[model samples]
Target chain A: QQPVQSPQAVILREGEDAVINCSSSKALYSVHWYRQKHGEAPIFLMILLKGGEQKGHDKISASFNEKKQQSSLYLTASQLSYSGTYFCGTEPDNNDMRFGAGTRLTVKP
Target chain B: DVKVTQSSRYLVKRTGEKVFLECVQDMDHENMFWYRQDPGLGLRLIYFSYDVKMKEKGDIPEGYSVSREKKERFSLILESASTNQTSMYLCASSFLPRTEDGYTFGSGTRLTVV
Candidate 1:
């Protein structure tokens, strides 16, 4: 089944911060995050395997909660370059990875 | 850098025509995948190959097939094009079993079926 993402769309000004959440009904062994610009393919950002582990890239970071079967992506001090759609792909116990609908983020300068 | 290359950036085809989308990866990854992206559905996997001459069906495999004749190349074939098949197709490659790194994707092919 596809994961569920909260706040389908979000807008922020420069230096602002936001968090996008992804929740799955099934137990997840891993959660992968990716970003995609308009008219482009999705680019890998980071993958979280163990629960309670946090990974960061630039101003972006993410955390995975194994017991909750959820993951959250954090964008700190948002920049114009961060304007894009972010997707969370969840790997359930079956090991089949599936992507969520994605959260469209627009950062204004 | 690990590079995944798709043969075409844009393609136009008529209904009922056969379409082939080719992808090549230089990272020597063991797994290659084909997926189609639509407006709201996100990415739907069509097929994947774990090894040369080996293929597996993904979530949505109907109306699509795959071929992996060489270790570095994988092809997605649309037996008969339909209007519903017109979308952006993406190809990705990954090393066997998930590690820290994830799949590397190609630029993608925007196919238009009329």
Candidate 2:
């Protein structure tokens, strides 16, 4: 099943922060975060394993709670380049990987 | 860095025509995936391959068939194209499960079927 993402769209000013949440009905083995710019491919951001550890890449970070089947992507001090659609892919088991609906984020100057 | 390459950036097809989207990965990954993206719908998986000649149906695969005759190449075939199938198609590849890295996606093919 596909994950559910919160905040279908978000607008932010420079230096602002935003959070995109993804929740699943089934337990997840890992959660993957990606960002896609206009007319571009989805770029990998971070991956969180089921161990409840947070992964960080530059100003982007994510946390995965295996027991709760929840994952959140965090963007701090948003930049203009941060404008794009964000997607979270979850692996419910060893073989199945599914994605959420997505969150459109626009960061203005 | 892994490179996932899609054959075409844009394509137009007529209704009832057959459509093919190709994807190739240079990273020798064990998994390849096909997904379609539409506004508000996010990315919907159509098919995936784990090995040469191996395949699995994704969430939305009714109108799509997949071919993976080679390890590095995966193809998505639309048996009979329809206007409703017009969308951006994306190809991706990743290592086996538990590799700790996310998928590498191709630039995408913007397919418009009229």
Candidate 3:
């Protein structure tokens, strides 16, 4: 089954922060995050394994909650370049991986 | 940098026409995938090939087929194109058996079936 994402769309001002949530019903082996700009391909951001690790790059960070079978992406101090669609791909096991509908984010300067 | 190349950037096809979309990966990755992206539908996997001559059906693979005759190439075939099949097609590749591996995606082919 496909993962579920919350807040289908978000609008933010510069320097603000936003959180996007993704959850799955099955035991998640890993969670992958990707960002796609307008008319561009999706780019891999980070991957969180089952070990409950929190990974970050610059002001973007994410956490995987193994117990809840959920993951949240945190965008701090949002910039204009942060405007795009964010997708969360969930892996139940080595054989299956699926992505959510994606959360559209628009940041205004 | 790993590069996954898709042959056509845009294609227009009539109903019932046969369509072929090709992808090539220079990274020599073991896993190649074909997915279609639609608005509000995310990316739906059409098919995936792990090795040459080996293919697996994904979540939405009923109307699609794949071929991997060589290690660097994977092709998706639409036996009879329909309006519903019109969408942005993306090709991705990654290392096999690595649950945490991040996929490298191609620029994508926007196919329109009329």
* Among all candidates shown, the one with the greatest lDDT: 3
In model 2 chain A, the worst 10-residue window by lDDT is A92-101
lDDT scores in order: 0.91, 0.92, 0.93
- Candidate 3 residue-wise lDDT at A22: 98
Q: Report the lDDT of model 1 for residue B73.
A: 99
Ranked candidates (lDDT, high to low): 3, 2, 1
Every model's TM-score: 0.96, 0.97, 0.97
Flag regions of model 2 displaced more than 4 Å. none
* Preferred candidate (DockQ higher): 1 or 2: 2
Tens digits of per-residue lDDT for model 2 on B50-112?
A: 889999989899999999999999999999999999999999999886577789999999999
TM-score of chain A of each: 0.96, 0.97, 0.97
How would the docking of model 2 be graded?
high
CAPRI class assigned to model 1: medium
Best by DockQ: 2
Tell me how many clashing residue pairs each candidate has: 0, 0, 0
lDDT per residue for candidate 3 within A26-91, as digits (tens), equals 899899999999889899999999999999989999999999999999999999999999999998
The true-versus-predicted C-alpha distance at residue A87 of model 3, in Å, is 0.4
